[model samples]
Target chain A: MKKLINNPSDVVNEQLLGLAAAHPELHLSLAPRYVCRKDIPQGKVAVVSGGGSGHDPLHCGYVGFGMLDGACPGEIFTSPTPDQMYECAKHVDRGAGVLFIVKNYTGDVLNFETSAELCKMDGIQVQCILIDDDVAVKGGGHTSGRRGVGLTVLAEKIVGAAAQAGYSLGACADLCRRINQNGRSMGVALSSCIIPEAGETTFLLDNDEIELGIGIHGEQGVERRCMASVDILVELMVEHIFSDPEYVRVAREMNSASGEWEDVQLVSTPFSRGESFIVLVNGMGGTPPGELYGVYRKFAELCDEKGVSIKRNLVGTYISSLEMQGCSITMLRADDEMVRLWDARAVTPGLCFPSCDDVTSCGTSNAD
Target chain B: MLTKKNVLIWFEKSADAMAEHKQELHLLDAAIGDGDHGINMNRGFGKLALELPVMGAMTLQEIFKHAGMVLLSTVGGASGPLYGTLFLKGAATVGTSEALDASAVLTFFDAGVEGLVARGRTEENDKTMYDVWAPVLREYELCLEAEMEFVEILAACVCAAEVGMKATIPMLARKGRASYLGERSIGHQDPGATSSYYLINALYESIRE
Candidate 1:
């Protein structure tokens, strides 16, 4: 209630204006609240994404040379209007096609579907890739699927690289599926967020409480109990992701969908690792990057124990929950070609990769 | 009594009650669900009050349909869609009827409850809106079958609605955010049912006038 702002209603618009002013390389549309690259490449595949506001530098900051083509930012923790997303498709259309990266939320899904219908009226081709990487809440009949968390940002990054690298619409979309399939994310929220208009916290939790698998919007998680040591929380999150049989099936489908079968890249060899990936350690808002990296150490330790090679690592506040303290870990298992795309250099105000490296397949833990 | 002006009065009274009890509703939901029920319902009814005067002497069905639109566009949550659809479905059944008699009112309420069931996909014991709606509908039908006068019928429906609302206290939630709490959801009253009772109370007060 006693925070800095001109007005509650104008908070989202004012922040978007500031974003536009800071990032000259991105195009900003006020009506639709879309942030797209200044120069949309002609006849190339376009990656479109969106979600509620408050998770700044996500869909917007990812709009750069090697990431998302456009992002439709909506109201705080609410889905954007269908017209907003439809207009985003208009501005970012490159003629090859546009791929919509949608999160797994009922409102988000319904609004995106409405936007897709509008795009179809214009004879533009589009496909949807739903990111439901959270392993918790799968058994709940109330939810359509698990919430999309850190994997969404990673998927946009990987698939954006593929689209920027001159891949066809179909090929780019296939890569998106691959990224979504092989990735998983889980989060814990130490506190709840305070919506500006509401003038109070969205939910109140005791000082010793933490909710496991909580979403960025402060949506109820799979479990709520007294807080525990970071190691125990990490085990619970990782156990569900690594032990689920469905996760492996999804990985298999992704490998084939991205056309890895047609290419000779599926095999492990001396020259390159069969597959490499970047580990994304994301902090919900109010959590510092230092703490995020602390969680990242655990992700790295787990990958080493499992013999899964991690070529690169990203640890920071890529996604946030508007002043909620917590962190989510996402593991993007990438193939040979995917590792190359991920290694490609890119610069944006929100995310930057200034360095890249290649390593052997499977366990390189014994090395360094 | 039961004039169109009385309908307007009922809405005004309900808005005041909702405002007064807003905090209590929020506290009930604080444990099992998001703590926005009181504010959300109050806002929905507030908008309904602002628009009721402009309904232009339409039939009860038309008036309800207009009220449904105001709630759907302004409420901005799950309850908005569910409750809005309920009213609209009820209006659809009444369809240009000039007046609402005993049996006509019962049929309309039944349609509204059925619409809630379809929208939420919940059943009688789901610890949802139906927990209140189903019992109120049953009592309403009985009153109509007994050939009770309009005022007496309204009183019966409101009493039934209250009983249904309070009955939510002991049941386990089977839908929405409350369901996520499992056994923890048992102690708190269902916020949706509490709001539905206010809606029914508003309807009865309108007729009693």
Candidate 2:
């Protein structure tokens, strides 16, 4: 367990200090900890999302100009408490309202639900959107349904863009839900990750085996397969995503009108040929950009083979597991609204899709 | 009646219990769920140990409420909410009383298990804390019906708690992260149930002493 740290207990805080120093534009609060943008525009619908802390540049890093207004991170792989979420919503709420983009983990769901109740009690108009787009999960009877994975990154972006464009709280919540319904993600882990306090690998695996259907946490995936080449790996994952049946699950959303939680039924249509996709090839912490591009290469080649169009793509280590050596791919079947939202200008500490608004610095007109 | 002093002792003793069994719980969960149950439990109880002094002026219900709030904010995993809900709901049932009688204790435990069922969305044989809690509640109720003393009722409940903890070894998990393993989750004792056993047994020990 060789790593850089002062103490196991101080890992999350010390690293968050580093993040605050590196990106001074984002505000950091240690007590009831959460990070929000310093210069939030007035009257914009606030978008807040968070989960466990190990997945960096995710909920926190995506807080900036055109994305999330704030993020509340929990312990390494634990859900943040309701106080943090409640405080963040209060800090970021600018009279329009706040929307919480929550993942589908049991702890996360419960904590966020508790936070929504608290916020509603205080007269805040809050709505929640649950993202459960992992295609690896088949059903949702007695178990927690699909785990929210890579698609969360897309949701924060697209929904953030909608809010920036003056979408109301209900409209932003509905748009995020629509994005969730149109996405699927699948991950494979080649190695186990260690939590800072645990100081041990989460799972032991053979040198020639890979874990499939993995969530971002260090938990073991659903299936283990013998290792294969990158092409075969990407092909297997794409099949897992494309062939997944229509996923129907019941998720709770806070209804602002009645101040009640409604069990909403959501269905995700399976991927098919001739469909266009906004694709993401995400490295699970340990994989480098060069290898991710290698994955994107195979993924793009497969898309070409299947006659599916790649409308927009991001190949990076964005949504990550904590130092796990593998990659996950997310494909959001695109509509015109989502595509346009994807192209919106985003400038966060973790992600940057800037529009370069200052045209005067360009066009080679320096002689004037 | 369980005194406020005994409630504080239970919390302080449970902190040590969590620390003592931390490694064992971590190893058990490592085989099935993510290996953090022990760490989360220790973290939450360690805070409770420190917060115990400030709760001196509070009633039995207030102590439970404070403990519930501490667990809710400090513990991060699924165990946090489940245990937090247990204490908070238990506090609501015990009322603002300075002491809880034997039946009040039983009612307290029942309310907690009910909250666990509602929050975890779980049932019997789901390989959850409910596995241990359900049996403990049943045994406590039976002992009370048979007109046992308070000490004897707690003793029976603790025994039932241990049996329930062991009963999870053969369960095919249908909830939480262990369910992801499908068949592979079998043969491992559940970490959540084990921690619950420690806490429940700690309460009985505190009262006995």
Candidate 3:
């Protein structure tokens, strides 16, 4: 119940204000509450994404060059309202168009869908792509579908790079869809974190137990088990993700041509040997890097044992569950194009790639 | 007939109900979903309670639309968009009239429920707010077909919503965050359905006279 704060209700707004002040590169709109790049290059397809506020260094932190053009943040652990998304898209959309990268949560899906409809009504071209990359939730008729976790970070970076490279809205959306279908994530929680509003931990775990397949929002995971060695835990998570059966789920997407929403069947193929991946071993805000590296050390060895290649690796607390003590592992199988885009130059508060090092790779060598 | 004052009273009562039961809703959600349903619903409805008085000079249609936008702007969750759309789409069924007859009430709920279904992509048994909304709309239709008074129809809706809310205790959630629990989601009443019941019940209490 005790944490540093003036008022619980004003937490989100104050955080946004502080972030806006710290990051001069972003344009912060307090009324509708969205953060977009101060200067989106004219005619570039605007990439926008948003969700609840707890997962920091995510939607907003990723708002910058070669990432997202804009991000709408909602209350802690709550989805942003449609007006936030609508206003953000409107602010960021240049003459080209706007692409909405939505996670597959019901709140995110509903709010973003409504916002897209509103944006389209204003004659702003828009396309929404949903990210569902968590392998923990079994995909079926009687489930909420898989939750979008760590892969959202990857999708934003790759899709953001493509958009920055002057890809069409359709092309950027297609790349995002491909990334979602190719990635899977699983997380484990040593303990749950307290929500500021509730002033209590979300769930209780015995001293000798941990929750497996934990969600990012402090929801209960699929299973609880006695504490085990890091090696065993990491291997178990890796196996669950690598051997997940063909996942099929129906997602609602907007059909730009007909201006109506349509159910699109999305499938994620199981992982195989010899595949390359961009892997992320993320912390849940509480875990320190020393421990994260230990987890990654075991994970990297496991991938090598399985004959899979880690083309690029990121180890940090990029997305979190507000001081929850846990970590998630995300692995995205990347094709050549995806790999190339992943390396494209970009700069943001949470993620950074200096273009000063490489010239032609970012296509900046051409006459501007 | 249901007047704009009755509608405003419904919102005010809903705000009070959510505040009174905030802890209860939070407990229900904590069992299977994130423990914020109570806080979220209370925040949105409480805001509406404050915002409703300002609509005194407006028509019923304008009131509903303005209320929807306020909820849409303030409530930050699945319920925000769903409940917000319920009002916005229902406003489409209402005209500039400050008073609505029984048929108008039926038409309004029918459109509102349809919007909830579309927005939530939920079926009747999905263990969502639509679970309560679906049965309430059906009860409204039955009451109207039976040539009942507006008060009678509201009573039927309140009862139907209670039954629907209780029915969710055994449902395996097929939508929203609770569905992530799989079978673990059973044995608890849905928070969304519970909140929805309060809303419908509040309407009956508001216009009991």
Instruction: Please give the ranking of all candidate structures by TM-score, highest first, separated by commas.
Output: 3, 2, 1
**Tens-place lDDT digits, model 2, residues A1-368:** 98888899899999888999988888999889999989888899999999999997898999997799999999888889877899999999998999999998888988887778778978889998999888777656556788899999999998999999999998999899998999999999999888878788877779998998877885555589999999999999988987888888888887777887778999888777899999999999999899999999999999888888999998888898789999999999989999999898888878876444434322233442
lDDT of each: 0.73, 0.87, 0.88
Candidate 3 stretches with Cα past 4 Å from truth are A1-4, A354-368
How large an RMSD does model 1 have? 8.6
Which prediction has more favorable TM-score, 1 or 3? Answer: 3
Query: Residue by residue across B119-152, what tens digits does model 2's lDDT show?
Result: 7878899998889999999899899999998888
Q: How close is candidate 2 to the true structure, as a TM-score?
A: 0.92
Model 1 agreement with the true structure over A1-368: per-residue lDDT tens digits: 66678899899889888888987777888865788887877988888999878897787878877788889887677666566777888888889878889886645654565566457768777777678777665554443446678989878877888888888877886787767777777788999888887778887899999988887888777789999887788877777666654532111111223322121111111112244667788888888878877777777787777667888778888888888899887777777777788876666668765432212222125444
As a whole number from 0 to 100, the lDDT of residue A74 in candidate 1 is 72
Weakest lDDT window of 10 consecutive positions for candidate 3 chain A = A354-363
True-structure lDDT of candidate 3: 0.88
Best by DockQ: 3
- How does the DockQ of candidate 1 come out? 0.09
The two-chain DockQ for each candidate, comma-separated, is 0.09, 0.53, 0.83
Q: DockQ of candidate 2?
A: 0.53
